[model samples]
Target: MSTQRKIVFDAIGSVTTEQYDDPHAALEPGQVRVAAKYIGICGSDLHVLAGGHPFAQPPTVPGHEICAEVTEVGPEVEGVEVGDHVVVDPIMACGHCRACLAGRYNLCEPPMVAGFRAPGFGRTSQVVPARNLHIAPRDLPWQVLAFAEPATCARHCVGRLPESARENVLVIGAGTIGLSVIQALRIMGAGQITSVDLDPTKRQLAATLGADRTFAPGELDPAETFTGVIDVVAAQATLTEACTRVVAGGTVVVMGVPSGPREIPLPSMQRFERDLVSSGMYVPSDFADAIAWLADGRFDAARLVTDVFSLEDAPKAYARAQEPDSIKVLISLSD
Candidate 1:
């Protein structure tokens, strides 16, 4: 039921780790226990480590981008069982809430998010709701399977747009989120995808993954105004420039979320004329499609995984992601 491990915090800038009781709570009727195989080092995880974001109160287990295999299942868990491979969908919500009824569970007021908002599977073992699990692709590696969550989020955003939306797309930020959005677009058959970021490492990775074109920071503004542009850079400075790039009557997906109030220009409102639509978290339909795409070999999930480290070095992994140039990085929990 309980175990001990080092709990680290502010881990992006300085070392913050300790041995604490990492518990594997009991499974509910619709739950399963998983032996975590891969725990990705994401920007949000680094936000906690660097003291830059408000994900958790610190001294908490730090992993949300996770992939694992089911080791146990509750009696009511029918679709999955022991020895089955699966990926965890970490959102926890109350079914009675209005948002839940509307199928917008991510906006649940009393939200229970895994990793940050609740207990997650990054530790040695964890019990999660069966509804939160999907049978993992037998052929996919744990490292690549871990992207299911973010990729699901991006796919949900793409699905919301009109079916007639342009095939040419632009993604700002070559970070994991940006790259994940690009991958999701590929799953949907978007004809061309362009990625832009200041970091060459990220751009290069974007090109490797699927981006048809990669542009430098300021170098991207000159490219064709996109029918759809995703803004993963949430800072006011980044948002302002991104807004300028969204074409009129086009769709600009604002996936970037930054902390604190932002400064905005009145001129930025003109982009709304471009039919701005915002999206959040994974919707069920979106997750399903992304998972199927992963299983379908439409894109190479395995190739996206560029770096892996031991759980003990998780803090270092976060540090590397925050570096000037960092690609997809993950943590292997097994000894």
Candidate 2:
């Protein structure tokens, strides 16, 4: 297609689909042209739409969790070719920064994340950096494969867990990230996994998705504590709960991207000597691991996407994702 359809966010609460010139008209070296197959609506996207994400601004194409088929590969790119199904890792970092130098690109300063500060792959086709492409089996549905990015984050967060915290893990929030954490913990051989969320629907889904027990936030006993608490929802209340519910010398992994600053219950955490680790986006290896899980059916990617909309209905998809019962909303770009 010489021209492609794209959804551009023009303002705090406005998004529209419009036609754009071919994204592949001029592909730089080390780049690959992809026909985006499916795109998942993430919590961060909602935050951006609400003018809450720090990296986002008006007049941007907003999407990051993506799955696509290679349409063309630059001469210098290797290991990928046309017709290959792949997941895109949208983190763009300044290579000279300390975080990038140390292989922690997710923590790069002045972050230029695709779909936020840079043009994202929300349209039919776009040119992508070769390094950001992760090849995946084409057998899985594009919607399922689109979860690779979020799954990668969950995988990275699980990798941060200490040995002592592998057992009796409590996952706070059964949203997409939390559900992903539940599956990752199961794959990591966690014991007595418990998931808590405000919505009963998500709690029940958590149980079906491998959580040993699912409970509403209010249903949890005040005295109960865990060796590890993964706060996937990282809002003020959830962060407070995560810090308060950890056992002595336990670890709390914060995986959420909060819209604004909030106070943490640091006194309790410090008194208990609890370790607080903040996890951001994943590295390339994390994306590979997630793809492997999805490839062999080790993880059920289908159940996580609770709603789907066409590329033209991305605005609707974002709104549905904000609903408490919606687990993951997807914008389907291909048949």
Q: Specify the highest-lDDT model's number.
A: 2
- Per model, how many backbone clashes are there? 6, 0
lDDT (10s digit) by residue, model 2, range 185-249:
99988999999988888888889889999998789899999999999888899988888888999
Candidate 2 at 188: error in angstroms? Answer: 0.7
TM-score of 1: 0.87
| Worst lDDT 10-window in candidate 1 | 4-13
State the C-alpha lDDT per candidate.
Answer: 0.71, 0.86
TM-score of 2: 0.95
lDDT string for model 1 (1-335, tens) is: 45645335533456444455745666678878778887776677767665666657555667776778788888687878787877777778886788989988788875677767787446767777888777866787666677677778778777765544547787888776788788778767787888988888778888988899998977765655767777788777666665666666667677887676765444555645766667777766666777777776665556656678777886677667776565667777756
Q: Candidate 1: where are CA atoms >4 Å away?
A: 1-7, 10-26, 221-224, 263-272
Which regions of candidate 2 are displaced past 4 Å?
none
TM-scores for candidates 1 onward, in order? 0.87, 0.95
